[model samples]
Target: MGQGQQEQVATSLAGAVSEEISASLAPVDAELERRYPGDPGTRQPVHTVYVPGDAFAADTIRSWGDQALAALDEHAPNAASFAAVLGLSDELAEPVHSRVRAKLEHEPIEDLRVDFEDGYGPRPDAEEDETAARAARLIAEAFKNGTAAPYMGIRMKCMESAVRDRGIRTLDIFLTGLMEAGPLPDGLVLTLPKVTYPEQVGAMVRLLEAFEKARGLEPGRIGFEIQIETSQSILATDGTATVARMIQAAEGRATGLHYGTFDYSACLGVSAAYQASDHPAADHAKAIMQVAAAGTGVRVSDGSTNVLPVGPTAKVHDAWRLHYGLTRRALARAYYQGWDMHPRHIPTRYAAVFAFYREGFAQAAARLARYANRTGGDVMDEPATAKALSGYLLRGLDCGALDIAEVARLSGLTRADLESFATPRRGDLTASGK
Candidate 1:
């Protein structure tokens, strides 16, 4: 067709019809944009390491790294031994093993949460207040000194009637200390645990708003994770999904929905022996949470395991296998993040993540390269698939599972290029028909 003919063929609908349709759907479009803005396109940590409030010290992060390395040294002792325990393929054994050790030695704790909740139990009001303030100061200093995790904050007590006032006071003290120390760190993260109702979420929103007003900061500057520990948080008594309501009630301050393994399991009366992240009840709850949080800029995190890797070499190896398998399963399901309770869990966590990303890195990079260049291959690609591919590579890079140089070498795309594809606007995705 001639250029003029092609120009004339643009958009079959009449101008007036198009305008009317757009005008009629304006509200719907606005709502869609408001509710589903896709991911926030930030770096999501692979795991959150929870340290008890009183136990968290200036050197806590480094201690965890050292302990993780010690665990590896005493148990696996070498790359081959570690790989054999996790059944890593020969191709991945060396790279994955070396990477895991390096990660442990360097960025061992991506996300650190000083737990003022179950981990702290019930401390006296004065003691709790002091501890919270101390935690704030330490976290602020750590971030300022460049020793903080990529994300660091506290998991405050739940909003239940019994602990509501205390939780509020503790959060206030912590935030106040942070402000006093310095402007809150960009990596600061807060978690509201055991959220059983949407109103609880609203309360958190109000609290953050008040803090912002008091601190003279911008409105909506604070966001917190809602810990889903109760069955009611997943399925309301009235037959609605309470977790969904919780997200809406946050008024965009909810950053995550973290499943609470033991608490959630016990809430449903699941036997202790049967309680696990892969349990049917746990999976059901997380599935609902995932659907509800999809495209809302809120991430979902799986809960932790109670099994600690502290025993004979054989027993530790068994625990490592269990943790590694669970991590792999969660990765395959696209969860990407979970909880690591003990320092010992770090090795397996990194191993599973590294393997998961490295095993498929070549294919994902090649596919994305093809999609970006519009080179047809054995498999036809769509924009959504391209988005997923880019996002996968981005996540791998974020958590140290994949390096930028290697990624660029294989994908022929820079980090910035990957980000562009990973975080395209909804309109952009539709307009760029691959």
Candidate 2:
């Protein structure tokens, strides 16, 4: 009787109802697609080295590499000694130490920014114009000769009333110089510092638009990083999240949001002693930035540590310990990139980065392999987790923290396969993967 009486239960809403709902929400869907396009699936550098515009030269990259190696030779001459200073495990000592040295020799600075802001200070108008033009010419030569950092650019002055026109003039001179030198280098970057309002981001977009038009380049071709220096950059007077608005105002031209440790801390009235990237104030600002940039194809970068690795061996070691610990902490928190101020800081920066990836290499690769192969393990992983794992391995490879052959052997996946997994599909942005 039950079998005869049961009715088919597959009939409910008509097919047109589903279509109608989708039609009604079409604009919302478009907004979602436009606003949250996820990671761009490109190589993000491990650290940005800021050299004053006046100090930057054709041989600056090699000079930094040499200085880093000399520091290593003097302070921690051997792998064992260097490992002891940074408290590396016995297994990681040799590999990490050797990799650090090799990285210094081969590719010391991943991203180099010639500072025209705080680091460069105020220069006479004619002097700055000449320097900006010279910077562009030298950078062009470096790239042509294959001696340039993988990424190179300038950090122009802020949008504040005091320096707005000056910043615009410098950026114009720099980009114009590059255009005259040749088609701009593909690795070119620009930074806008001390953004206090989203309107400033709009201003930057307009500025870039003008440059592109004048140079007969495609629209929206130039992108820049928005530096979060003042407290107003994080929160508005009305308590709204200004950073989120800034990203929207960028109109797809924002490549990154970089924290400015000292300026931000000082803006909040934090004493000089407590001004650091890890300070509570800095954490709050960066956390907001991380959220704001999560699915918007914009990366977040931590600021530099003021502690330089200099002086006697003992003092150098102390500075190394501090820098290493801070770098490791940032990596753990998923802030994959930071600023490296000095050539000597390069050693500890690479050491910490290598050790972080190397220590977790096995687990990440295994999890990714299992997820890729659809074989269950004690820890189950979803597609997003697979993306994260592949991304981790890729970053390791990019920064010399892990090698492709070893990663392939361990994960049973090729570089192409990892790239497929690491690249995000539209409408998903659960992890930064940078």
- Cα lDDT, all candidates: 0.93, 0.92
Cα deviation of 92 in candidate 1 (Å)?
0.7
- Clashing pairs in model 2? none
Task: For residue 208, give model 1's deviation from the true position in Å.
Answer: 0.8
In model 2, state the lDDT of residue 146: 95
lDDT of 1 by residue, 1-434 (tens): 76666444457767899899999999999998988889999999999999999999999999999999999999998889998999998899999989999998889999999999989999999999899989998998998889999999999988999998999999999999999998888998999998888999999998899999989999999999999999999999899999999999999888999999999999999999999999999999999999999989999999888899998998999999999999999988888899999999999999999999999989999999998898989998877788899999999999888999999998899999998998887987777565
Best by TM-score: 1
| Global lDDT of model 2 | 0.92
- Identify the runs in model 1 with alpha carbons over 4 angstroms from their true place: 1-14, 431-434
* Angstrom error at residue 387, model 2: 1.1
Give the per-residue lDDT digits (tens) of candidate 2, residues 201-314. 999999999999999999989999999999999989999999999999999999999999999999999999999888989889999999999989999999989999999999
Which 10 residues in a row give candidate 2 its minimum summed lDDT?
Answer: 425-434
- Report backbone clashes per prediction: 0, 0
